[model samples]
Target chain A: MFITSIGYYIPDGRITNSDITEILVEDNKEHFSKEDIEFLTYSCTRKFEFLGIETRSCCSEENGDHFASMAEKAARKAIDQAGIPPEEIDCLIFSGVTNPFREPSFAIMLAHRLGIKTGDFFDINDTCNGFMKSIDVAGLYLKSEKYRHILVATCESPYDLKNTLKLDIHIENTDQIDNRLSGLIVGTGAAAMILSSDGGKGRITHYGEQRTSNDWDASMLTLPGTAVPGAKYGDTITGFWSDGRLISSSLIREMPEFILRKLSEWGLDAQSIDLFIHHQLGNNVTFALMDKLNADHQKAPVNTFKQFGNMATVNIPVNLAIADEQGLIKKGDSILLLSSSCGLSYALLHIVW
Target chain B: MTFDEFKLMVSDGLGIDDTLLNRDLSFRDDLGIDSLSVINFLVKIEHKFKFKFDVEHIWAMKNLGEIYDTFTEALNNK
Candidate 1:
């Protein structure tokens, strides 16, 4: 299957380092010491600089923006760009970490909002790998010839007060500071892609072998699904933890080998791929991957994390949309989407656009 | 590579003075070599030794000495 259209929506509330620090201090005043607050604020600045994330976008709660609404906006843009009747989309997949509820998949809700009459609808959660995995699933359905068109969409709002402020910020050690701050690195954004079986410019040629290591537990958001007995209403989805250093470093160490092996198997080299669209983990991870592959720096869009922060699954699609708008992609250009998720899942998908 | 040789590579790879290096120095705390840099240095070691170190072990090795011991053990096994 080939991608017919792509679109994204980044919320308007531009959040800066100072804003994050203010929230951290204001929310945890009675819980942390003066020194702890000072140290964490300093650490936030340092980490943001090291991660190369300058600013992030946050949705306004007053505007009633939630995951479903954001996904609808992004999906509508994708459908509009597809230039096809909404009825043509035979499948809708909502792939994102942040969801409005545990039941009634966002896809079911989105289909109604988008005016899609008949289609298969569901949700997939693979953390940052959600979108890529959704596309992978869509390709399988399209290959079966049962589905003519599919829309895969994602909307992540990690910066919501309920999600961010609820983090267990009672830091007992400096190491915990780094781990907790990773959750705060994410901003709010939505992205969508429309894939079709018919002729299109972008085609998924191969989905590489996914390498899953035990390191996924190194970073996680405790969602409601893992709720325990006697849990309070919001006990789940309260804690967001991550070893940002371990995750980024491990990806740097592991991705080169995994990708190179896949490239050799696919009978291609790194230099031949026109664009290497990486999951916008950070500048460190993206640039490090490029350096290890010994590929041209210009072949990859390296500044999305710095410009947009980490939108989790939304990073790649938003980057793809930006690249398209910037005239970076051309017909028949080989593209590789390198995705690494919190589950320690790694995948490299080859596409010709 | 000997501990001295590893120190030299660490100094060269991370752009620090060789004299400042020590076996007991915490890679993150003492040398200020962030986790990303430590892994990058380990990647260089992997290239030098022609073998792959366990990715998970990279985070568990807290000190320069621990990293050296693990590398030595892995290289000897290889």
Candidate 2:
């Protein structure tokens, strides 16, 4: 059984395109063309205010406690939906680009929050591919006769890094900070999924991964987080910085071949997928990938970039839960989950709902 | 340019209430000017004065007074 239950949360503040356009115009005389501004507004969901976000929320102003809150929200919702008590959960996984602290795995805090006393807990650091990998891991765990129920949760919040980065670096006519900061639009959200041994609403039929470290050039788009030097807590480091043009060029070159290989592994054609749920990278990247795959836009549900920014690892599950809420995915429909993370890791999962 | 006009432009550009801004207030601490807000402020100053800011000049700027001096120097140089 796969994804017996799924839940997601988006902060309440709504930042409309008009608000951004107005702010930009007043801030700078070089105004965005109305069409371009509208494209940005319609293409990505952004937060203009912090209304619904609590002080303890994952994306909140405070630090360290946000991840626990996100995990609790998603865990409680999924457990309730699955009709299982917390004690019955056998395994728990936390996946995301951002964690609240360095030690005490976010999964441990989540297990504590959910009161899942009888589960093995761990975390995966795959960023955008996190949810897909966590799903695959949980599936593998459930295959064991010793495990019955597994819960996987992913939470991402990149906004705090915005203030730390020096905004002065200019790369290709755009500030490196702005280009890097634009990645922040991939909103802050958490998603939890419940997997069971008994067959239910959905099943993961196949999984595949392809690594292309030769294109490590794509990893240039990085932030000063745990992976980088001088990024320890309270150090006040630079935020995200990137050569957007360079990253875009490399992704275009690498992703088409990656997608084709994954599709081939599933022994399925692009037309066979009833719903294509891919990573929420950005508008341009998503369009480029779909164009290469010759995917039917109708079959692909891409709200990740447009509605929730990128949410890194939370992209897939958040998209899936939104689809479930919107009635986009029905029982017995074939859904394709694909993601490409930093470190040049690519993964694909085929789920039959 | 008159200080009043420069103050008005700064107020409009930074989205600060016009009444709260004056030539006496410091941009960084008083206005809480950030790098993004400063970049936007420079863009506004360039348009208002009809001059382009060299990337290096922007990097050198630390405060409103420095920006004002730089703008005047660029104008005089032009």
Largest TM-score belongs to which candidate? Answer: 1
Per-residue lDDT of candidate 1, residues A1-353 (tens digit): 88899989987777888777787777667777787777667656655655567788788767777777788899999999999789888999988886655678878889999999878999998888899999889988999998999999999887663454454444555445666777667878999999999876688888875656566466766643465344322334346767766676677777788999999999988989999889876655676588779987789864677666788899888888888889999988999988888767888899888
lDDT of 2 by residue, A1-353 (tens): 56688877655434344444344433333445555444333222122111111111125444343555766787788889889888888889888776655588878778887787756898887656788888878777777666888888888765443333322222232232245434434467778888888855788888888776653433333444335543221233333443343444545556667768877876887778898787765444555566667876667755556545557777788777788789998888888887777656778788889
lDDT, model 1:
0.78
- Candidate 2: C-alpha RMSD to true structure equals 14.7
Q: Flag regions of model 2 displaced more than 4 Å.
A: A15-65, A161-184, A215-237, B1-78
* Best model number under lDDT: 1
lDDT of candidate 2 at residue A232, scale 0 to 100: 20
- Proportion of native contacts found in each model? 0.18, 0.00
DockQ of 2: 0.02
**For candidate 1 chain A, which ten residues in a row score worst on lDDT?**
A228-237
Q: Tens digits of per-residue lDDT for model 1 on B1-78?
A: 799998887789888998998888886546545565554456556656766667545555668888888888998999
Q: What is the lDDT of residue A352 in candidate 1?
A: 89
Error of 2 at A133 (Å): 1.4
